[model samples]
Target: MTTSLAPDPAPDPGLDPAPDPALARELRRERAHHDACRAALARMAEDVAEQVVTGEDVAASGADAEVLGRHLRSRAKEFGEQPPGPLFFGRLDREDGQSHHIGRRRIAEHPAEPPLVVDWRAPVSRAYYQAGAHDPQGVVRRRRFGWAPYSAGDTADLTGLEDEHLVSGEDVVSAIVAGEIERPRVGPMRDIAATIQPEQDDLVRSGPGTSVCVQGAPGTGKTAVGLHRAAYLLYTHPQRVRRSGLLVLGPNRTFLSYISEVLPALGETGIRQSTLDEEIARHEVRAVDGEAAARVKHDVRMAEVLRRALYARVALPDGELALADGPLRLRLPAEVLAGIVAAVREEAPPYATGRERVRARVVRALQLRAERRAGPLGGAWARRVERARPVSAFVDACWPRTTPEEVLAAVLADPDDPLLTAGERAAIRWAKPPRSFRSARWSAADLVLLDEVAGLIERPESYGHVVVDEAQDLSPMQCRAISRRADFGALTVLGDLAQGTTPWAARDWREQLAHLGKPEAEIVPLTTGYRVPAAIVDLANRLLPELGLGADVPAGVSLRRDGEVRLCRVADVATGVVEAVKGALAREGSVGVIAADEHVGPLTSALEAGGLLRAGGDGGAGGAEATGGTADVVAPESAGERLSVLPARMAKGLEYDHVVVAEPAAIVAAEPRGLHRLYVVLTRAVSRLDVVHGEPLPDYLAS
Candidate 1:
């Protein structure tokens, strides 16, 4: 069935060209020779299929493997790499009188017009070979079906392709491959090492590397490609890679929810997904048994401050006070108490002064007073005070209580409190503030709360892969905890060194990464950014170095559109935010506005008035509550209703159709590490990006 279309050649003009009749006959002979080769190819396919099904080695028997190998090697030699799709076919005379080997194809490059070489052994292969050949002049002609862009139908057919046809990129490679047809390129391929890029696809298909790092720039389809690659690996090598071996780590739980449906869409089960931080939190809070490395390191503390604060607010009375059940009545009201405490002990030494000393004194005083005044009036007041104690203790526990009031008084007395050492001040700074100890105790409690939270990491079998997104923002200690959870599978860390700020340790994350494994660790760097348009990325790159920082935005960024990177100052923050909102909504649909902190009251109002945003729950800066509301262009109340207006700190590893960076000037002026933080926010947009400033950004960003 092969079609031939050879244009008529110019007739010879020379009178001596007497063999016009003879040349035509010779051309006919050449066509017949090609036809015989095609028939022989079909016979070879039949023999190959029989041996394949019999489980006998095809190469061990007759010319089956030889004939096919010659055809493929010839094509590979000429074409540099064979085009994917029934390279050979086999025909079988079974009881039903027909036999089939599954259809197989390749997704590779082809230079110029390519020839078809079909074998007739397998049913699908025979379809190509059975198309037949033509005696058109001296040249042979046939049509070889080539793979096109994956359409919905092709994606459907993928599920039915034979396993052998689903070879890995590594399995089929051509350093000098040539093809006129342009190949579709996507994903984070460039970030990986060059030695591996040409073959990574192959490795992915085979599933050999213990760890694979897909270091993708913003919007480079890192997540999209990773998801599809995971599916591809599973489908191609069903026995080697499975949903169980694959794990996709996003930035947070909500992120996990966002991409949860990709795999099922591709007709494959979705792989495991979770946040790196929560996984670490779960490990520390639920399994920690041994004491942390530093029981009390001022700055290098290994404690969950947020978790501890929450526990002190609701579960304990007088966060700093410790007592046994015999004296528990002094700590809680009968109604407010969850249950009678059997016993309690001091885990850490009593605090040095202020609330710590006061709380300890009250615990003892209340025990004595309550024991003596066992009657009605005294009992009622004690109960009320105890009930009020938890709330009072909660407020106090959140602020500094360890500071000697006199010392703080001295420090505050002077605008320049340089005399106080940073360590001593920090120690006092994080301690719980003073609480009313009429019923609440003042002493700092044992480190038991922290201990309870640290026990979560006792075992590591619960996870598959541990991937840390936005890793450059992480502290070394946080990185260590993340490494501990990789026991179930391998570890893949993604980060941009330019966004890091640790002067001493952050300077060399690669060295710190060595702590996780050998020097040859699977590390990859994503240079190209697909998030912002070329224009934005170029502007950012040009402006970043002017801040006097050596890190320029990577050159790989492409600003595909003409736009502005102007700094506008408003009469006030509100006015500036309003302008920013107008710019963000110009694109319509959903937009995201990230702030510097969780306190988004001012920005929220401006966005609402502009009819650009909706709000979600109040989960503080790093909490889970995304204030839910409608983002109707007409009435924007909640974050859900309006464009996404969030703090800049919370925008890591996220994207939006459009992004408006609110208050860059205040962020640069106020944050201790604003330069790096600001850059991170600016890179969150996949296409359109805006930075709203009430004042000019630091010279670095503005320049």
Candidate 2:
């Protein structure tokens, strides 16, 4: 279907067109309804606030009132969470003349009554998004509301509305939806519940029991889709979700902070938002991993090696011993004990469980022999035998229990482990092996290994649902870590394979899903680019095939036609970047200046030298309010800031209205997957991309 994406028409000063009275009346009516719902929600929160937990709420067996009180308080907070912006975005009229407004959340006068505004994820509200001229789905007409990008918590921000009359076969080229999608991202990311496409709706409404992976292209809204899916699950399955819990994982802390507001805006509060690095931080990462060492440490093979090393610690007895009572002599055969050890190993329980199993079997074996010899002794006899010094000593000596740190340290420090190659061993082994694992400095990859070993000892805590963004760059070992936490639940995986910049990034979604322990999860592709302009997407599309993602790596089509792309060849790249920033700042969107990790300082210096204020970290620089300066170079995590200068790596899950990339060749030369890194930062632009470089552009883009 063709779409008209012309920018908002500018009103003329010379001529005043006749005002449409119908539109004005309808908008006023809608605004009044929005105000009423806000009032109703406030009442709801007030009512919940007055609630008191009593004996009826808990059992007489003495349940904790404090726990119940917290639950009630949290529920009240959910009702009280009224984020700024449009509450309800669309209206759907069924064939039977019933009208329903769809919004980010449900709003009703009372708990037992039908909602005044249906939730966007409700089954009935699906028609508002999926209905078209051909398939109305019982919807006679659908109305879309247009509002200001950022509102001041007032209904005055409601500007215009559009309608689609399905029965009359009226197709809508919605200027509001296009404008919202094209709106510049300023501070933290916002919810897209109002503008979710049909394809995205399908993924968001997927069953809570199923694991699904989305191989979305840049600007495909995959990150937002994952967050929405999580909110959907929390809404649909409150008990099943909160029973174990829900987790949302991003690539880094900045990305997590970027998306921290999306779920809360959807009326979901207190949901755990974290990065993968922060999740498995068993110890402080005081050391960095060399390339070869990281490979060995994050290798899937290391999991098996850890298991073997842990189990090998169990010692088998050569001969049985005699259990001497005060006046009795008891003897057991060595083969009988050997049988128990063999059986437990074959059972393949967790390391801790296996040790207990062997001990229990050994004690039981001795008890049976004693009972048979003594001819039906009391049960206390078995207890006595269990606590007997001989039995305890034998079990402790053969079937030993150990910690993850102890086992891993021994495996790495072992100079003669046949499972590891000489080079592999040397690379991963600690140079100055500490006297204890507690005092040792662990690298990031080492923490992943430690997680694997910990899982072997006992299962990690499980979540009902897990959402991981930037998943294509997950190493096999890292995937195993996520798989452990979500073993009993399901995962909603989101990423773009072409944007994967890690050395161990999976080329195939199938491989990545397999490592995630969800091989059967459906691989869904979202190739439609909405946030990115077509020109920028086209530029990134040229570099896809070179990343070895296979022939089927589909090219994305940007729905935006008005996106701007420019190439600036300059003698000084820094100077060019400063100029681009100035131009981007002249407009009303966020500006991002991304360069190789090593070049961030030089670029920031250039911006500062060019009279731009540096809005940086807590101690280094500040935001507009902090610095009280205009044209600031901001940090990505600084809320309400308009400009961010970040390294290429931090650009993975972020977007901006205008992006100035310093050098393509330098980005490519930064790492082995440098080409993919270049592809990521290039596509981060929502409206325009300015390539400022002293060196020649990448071959694919140049051609």
Best by TM-score: 2
Off by over 4 Å in 2: 1-19, 53-61, 64-67, 321-330, 373-384, 615-640
Clashes of each: 69, 0
- Over the stretch 1-703, how does candidate 1's per-residue lDDT look in tens digits? 1111122232111112233454435334434433443454344444444444543444445577666565454333423222222222222222233423212221112222222321121223322222222311111222222112232222111111111111121122211111101111111111111111212333233242355444444444445445545555555554544423655666566556555555544334535676544444421332221122112221233233422332232233423333343434444343222221111113222222223433343444554655665533355544454445543463254323431222222222221223335543453332333332122221111122222233221223423444455555555444545554554555555555545533322444555565444235555545544335665666556545633434322434542343345455656766676676576555433456676663366777766666554343232211122423213344333233335567665665555545667777555544556666676677666556666666556665565
Cα lDDT, model 2, residue 563: 83
Please provide TM-scores, in order, for all candidate models, with all chains considered together.
0.47, 0.92
Say which candidate scores most in lDDT. 2
Kindly list the per-residue Cα lDDT of model 2 for residues 40-145, writing each as its tens digit. Answer: 8778777787774342366533446666777787887776675766678899989998999998888899989988889888888888878889888888888887
RMSD of each: 20.2, 4.2
- lDDT: worst 10-residue window of model 2: 619-628
Off by over 4 Å in 1: 1-207, 212-217, 225-229, 236-245, 280-459, 462-464, 500-505, 542-555, 559-566, 586-589, 611-632, 635-642
Candidate 1 has a TM-score of: 0.47
Local error of candidate 1 at residue 554 (angstroms): 4.6
Q: Which 10 consecutive positions of candidate 1 have the poorest summed lDDT?
A: 158-167
